[model samples]
Target: NVYYADFDKILLEVCVGKNRLKTERTDIYTNIRHFGRTTKKGYSFKAVIPVDKINGRDKIYFEYTYGEAKVRTSITFLSFQSRLSNKLPESYWIFGNSILSYDEKKKQMIVEPLTFGSHLKHEIKMMYRVARHGRKRIGKKKTLEMLRLRASIKLNRGFGRKDNDSISGAPKNKKPVWITYDQLFKGGDNGQYFYEYMNKNVSDIETCYIINKDTKEYKELTRKYDRKTVLPFSTYKTRLKCLKSDMLFATRIDIRLYMGFTENDEIYVRDLFKADVVCLQHGLTIQKIAQYQNKFYDNTKHYFCVSPKEVENITKPIYGYTNDMITLTGAPRYDGLVGEPKKQILITPTWRRNVTAGTNEKGKQHEYSVNFKRTTYYQIYNSLINDKRLIAAAKKTGYRIVYLVHPILSPQADDFDKNDFVDIVPGVKANYEKMLKESALMVTDYSGIQFDFAYMRRPLVYFHPAELPPQYAEEDTGFGPICRTNDELIDELIKAMQSDCRLEDSYKDNINNFFPYDDQSACKRVYEAALKITNFS
Candidate 1:
């Protein structure tokens, strides 16, 4: 049902059309019903417009007629084939490093929310959308139509097989190298750093990054670098490049999940030609609290080593990988870590699994509220942020704290009170890295960024409330003072500032143990490795 504001007397009629052809098509729709009443602000109604089929058109148009005024809108239809097609853009949230695991009991993927706010927001929205859909005509038929559409499309595509028969051919550029990050493309990660290094330093190797189309990152990349250096992720050109490329560098193999391609698709393509793959990991793997397993490590030829411990852990007997697959080339993302330290604190916390809220089955809007303030995270952080002791300590130390909320909590920035004492900074992924570079100290609870800060030889303080969710145990953090209460955190901060923010002796030892190289030659090492990997082909 459509709503009109402050309606007096208006004769309105709604009609459906196929493309530009307008008519009251009886075959396309059936049992049209309307239910609503007039309110002070407007006249609202629910018109149950159920369409049996789209009849092969890309979209159906709706015409709203009201007294010499005609408004138009169109609803696009997706056959199941189109749903899994490479034409659609992937969802943005998955790249935030949230884990999705298949639950056998529930028969659905368990999604953990990124922050307290997202957890609450999802819960609220799920309920609201479920109830709203019950009262709408579009609600009931939508799920059935979607399933039917999917089935119809799958039948046409020969079901669960590659549609790349048209793409089969010999290599276009035999020596081409391909690069990409996870589906969610961000800035200044290992992927971009590697691409930049290859373009400026390495020679005689054609390189291109797999980028999503119509994305701001894509536009920015094209504006900053050569437009021809990027290939659209889901297009024929990308598949051709992947098939023919001699070497592949990527942050993750999760692109398959995003593109609706299976492991078998990759295997089928791999059978044609062996493309040596190098994995430049996006972040340091914290095994204890890591939600997702390294499922793709076995598939790759080389894995970039961020630390000695990472290499050791991944090559354990259970992981089934040997040292032969490990390359001690440090992550390219860490090559340019130069910055003058400022009196600032960066707070980056890990996400939680228990706090995740699932959406309704029919995919309707949900409206509900979770007491975000009462959450364990809020209870601990809010106390420290608003505490007079911390404020006084901050003033004495001449330092300001910036709460770099996780990307998942992006929408819930308002959940915290904005004031001079604490700044809740949440914006672009690129800016987050920039902030890290400028910070003198980092306060976090089990985030991989700890490794990055430690690499800079800066002081770090870990504040974990006992009541909050369990991250990795305290022992897992080899260096850094662990503070459970606000008072402890304040005392630690003041002491660290008085010492001129030098990283402790233990931290130095840990840094040395983790990173074998601190000479800023990571990109060089990576390029040399790439040359060795491609020499055979």
Candidate 2:
């Protein structure tokens, strides 16, 4: 059974008996045997039933209690060996409302729920299939075929024919159609900077920037560029443009946002769109991420790197990227991280998994609002921001604290305690480039934004109340001194303020070593690399 963590308790009672013969009754405690949480924000549990006590005549009754509600379910016992014997013909199993489709060659079953919406109750179905003969992973061709079938149905219903025609009605040109986006809803990342560079420097190729229509960045961009060049994300026009694109550039590897596809459709849609993908990268590759490996990004033709160390990290056996795939170009956003900073301390922290329920394919925040404040992430940061010592230190140093909540945690922005000296800013609405340039010092907890701050040679303080290990241990990445407590963070801030928020000499050397290019020419290098990949150079 799968349930939210908010449930008071969950228990399973199994009764096995018939009309004439009575058998043993078992009460299984689900918490003792945990299968961990599912990706959809629900805890899964396995009940251990004694199969030896059951007979063919016995009726298996299963009852589970969640919150104040009690639900009774029944299941038939089927031996694993019997199922693998190939005695049963190819069949579709309907467990509750979900339909499980089994693939014989792949030896896997995909469970799809028949009902939709939050009020629908569903059952958990588990099917284990072991391949008798060695078979490769399921091919993407079948998935793409299904996606195209669905898309054709939608098109027949008059969905996107006009938009498709508008995008494909371009004059003949040798250059490829380039599509770039960053976070979909916002701009000012490497993708946006690269798009702007292409529009300014390279005129022969077609370029389109995808952004959310409701965003302030969209309004700003529409005013600056023609409407045809700036396309709203998840729209019919953007989806058609993605299908027609020859080159795709993004900070995130999830390319479904531009095509208005769900998370489940990412693999299929990536295979559907035949384009050379260039990873602009959201941040420096300091921490190890399994998804960034070569197998996951098979369509990626070029991966932008900031320094040799980052290139080395990606080329490692774990990441599995060849040396030729990496383009040694700094992030394009770094070119705009220039300006005289004011006497303000920026507090930016990354999001925690406990605080958010989950995100949709479009990257919208779905928060667990009811228990958001109860999380350790909220309580620790809320207390730290409102701490009198930190507040007084900022006041004494004549520096204001601007607490920028992560975009994923933006839904719970108001949950934090309000203070006089600190101003809470939602990440979605805030201009990150502006904040990065105007801040004197930054206080963060495992955020890649620290690299942006460090690029300006400014002082930074890492608040690690959880005592998380640094991403890079073998060598310094030129990050600030880590503070394990609120008091320690305040002390570090005070010290930084005393020295006029200047970066340490040792850290300066490390920063120079970390970034291969700091000449504000990252856009140029990235543009050249893109041209080379597309054979435009």
Best lDDT among the predictions, by candidate number: 2
lDDT of each: 0.54, 0.64
Error of 1 at 414 (Å): 2.5
lDDT of 2: 0.64
Residue-level lDDT of model 1, residues 1-537, one tens digit each, is: 334432444443333223243233111111123442223232222233333422322232344556677765332212221112121111111112121222232322233423445433532442343334433533454433323332332233221223232221122243456555543434556777777777777656766776566556678777867777776665555655554566667575444432223332332122223255567777764463111324233245677787877776666544434687778888787777878878887777765543323432111112222655567776667666777866777788888878876554444456777667688874334365578888888888877678777877777888777777564443465668788877888888778767767887887787777778876778889888766765533
| Residue pairs clashing, model 2 | none
Model 2 over residues 1-537: C-alpha lDDT tens digits?
343455336555555443122222221222222344224322223334443544433344556666777765433212211111222223333223333333444343334433332112211111111121111223354344434533542243221112222111222134578888888766778878887887888888888888788888788888877678888876656766676577778678656655565443332222224456678888877565634434234345678888787787777654545788889988888888889999888999887665677554473546547788878888888988898977887888788889999887788899898989999999877889999899998988778888888878887887777543334333435566877887788788878877779888887787787776777889889888887876666
* Predicted candidate 1, C-alpha RMSD: 20.5
Model 1 error, position 88 (Å): 24
RMSD to the true structure for each prediction, in A, is 20.5, 15.9
Model 1 TM: 0.62
TM-score of each: 0.62, 0.67
